[model samples]
Target: MASLSFVNVCKTYKNGLTVVKDFNLDIKDREFLILVGPSGCGKSMTLRMIAGLEDITSGELWIDGQLMNMTSPQSRDLSMVFQSYALYPHLTVYQNMAFGLKVHKVPKDEIEKRVGRAAEILHISHLLDRKPSALSGGQKQRVAIGSVIVRQPKAYLMDEPLSNLDAKLRSQMRVELAKIHRELGATIIYVTHDQVEAMTLGTRIVVMNSGVIQQAASPNDIYENPVNKFVAGFIGSPSMNFFPVWVARRGEKICLEFGKNKLIANEICSKRLVEDGYVGRRVYLGIRPEDFHEEGPEEQKILFDVEMKEVLGAEILFHGRINREEICVRLSPNVKAEPGERLPVYVDMDRIKLFDMDTEQNIIYV
Candidate 1:
């Protein structure tokens, strides 16, 4: 229900350590935007700035067309949920959820109506009489969220709200959060270090590193067309495999050669390499684990020395070496292969990515 804009925003400490560098982004109304990166990557710091918990060193912070850089947290009219539940231990679920409205002196009947609606939306109606001590971890989290829901703020800010729960609870909460987003149609800004959460929950993802924005795109674009080596290696589960290979011309064909092996490039990749005059130079060959296939043209096969295997239900991940460089391949579970065996696999030419050796940027996208 609200839109936010950060125009050339920055955050720096008194000790002169800058955490956010010229950050600029526009968040649309009713959007679920995720800020994702590793620890100390400025994701949480960015969220704090929006919540009025941190001062912006420079630039503008606007909310629904109002300048908010000088605004107090209370006047921001935004609700924030933290990793800790922070519920009052002595208050019942209904009382805890109604506390905020009571402090603001809302009508008693109106408070009751809001609490009932929130509890129903969160599926915690039956637990309204229970105290924080008697609720499960997930239920406690729901109560914390319900407290914010009653406020009905313009936007919601969440900083890893599900991180404190167990893995199973985290997965369950993920589904619950998705449903809440749809039902409320409220704008949400979420921050987390978990890529799975970023991929599944976000309508738009912003990837950051060292106080800089690396890439901002949808899940499919980030997975299929990463902007650089760091993103290509970070977004996926098993991560993309990298190899130092030479781009060379062999007769009338363009091929990538590493050690004693060679693989042909698809027409699109080959055209870029030649047009960019990289005929005889070193480049990084990037391939995802799932792009390796057990069936392909015989001439495109390479001997992969399997060192270990992990069976993950529907598929198997083979951790092996190709010409002394470590590699991981995800294949169908039906494919039979064992440790210490030479297994031949082919790379999907059309699905492969190439990166610049010096700049580390994706060559195809550059």
Candidate 2:
């Protein structure tokens, strides 16, 4: 296993296209770190740089205490699994898995032993005589990974390896991949645009946008304590609701205002607002869909009517408009709701997020 670090890393093409900007991350040994974002976010580029498939334009990449700027792919001590299986159709499972060892001129008996073990671990031992053309999509991916496993590299680099599989297979494989990692104790850096995969498989997630990292944290931390609006909106399903809010003092208590709605702030946030000098300033209020409720006992709660309700399996999403801003609440699917009804909303004052109006950066105390 190896620890990886990207220090002030950058990637710029010859056409003057800057894909990555001052990217930095320190991945620990045997850590399953996931890089996630939309396309063209430089996630794949970062992986390529680590794999020695692409040269860095600037900065440094260190693996296991060694700088890997000019090292070739073979010397990087890494195995990569691509979106496409990249398997040799003509070669049987054993031959395909053993090919790398053969090229390195490992003894025939040793190659057979390694390949056999990999196939067994992957549960493809019975398919050793079968070619890629005869295997299922998930099976092909397993064979591809088995090929990598036989190499016994220091790390595994996976780039959207499940994109081609059906939903059910992908889900199954995600769990299997986690198990395989534990079994091998290998460091893995997986790149995917799928948030579900990123959330479920990673020990830590690094979310990138436009070649810049937006946030890096554990799944729960990333969801609950996003640093800014972008991270807050991007990390969750149904996303968080944002609206303009004005900070002020109402009578003896501190409060925030949104159009006709006004709610006294909790002690924790009131203290923070005063400390951050946000009193009497226009800011943004962020609340997640799941955080919204009908009503709760607190100093105050902002209520809004339901304009629409969507039943999605275990949760019902309430769509309501506040000051021309559309907001939603995820509640129990068992709740009875309807359109055109003014629903009383129970805002969780303690769970609310505050952001600076100017920079759109979260102002909540970390």
**Candidate 2 whole-model C-alpha lDDT, 0 to 1:** 0.89
lDDT (Cα, tens digit) per residue for candidate 1, span 253-343: 8999998789988889999999988889999999999999999997578788999999999999999999879999999999999999999
Choose the strongest candidate by lDDT: 1
Candidate 2 lDDT by residue in tens digits, 82-150: 999899988998899998888788899999899988888889999999989999999999999899889
TM-score of 2: 0.94
Q: List the residue pairs that clash in candidate 1.
A: none
Candidate 2 residue-wise lDDT at 12: 97
TM, every model: 0.96, 0.94
Segments in model 1 whose C-alpha atoms lie over 4 Å from true places: none
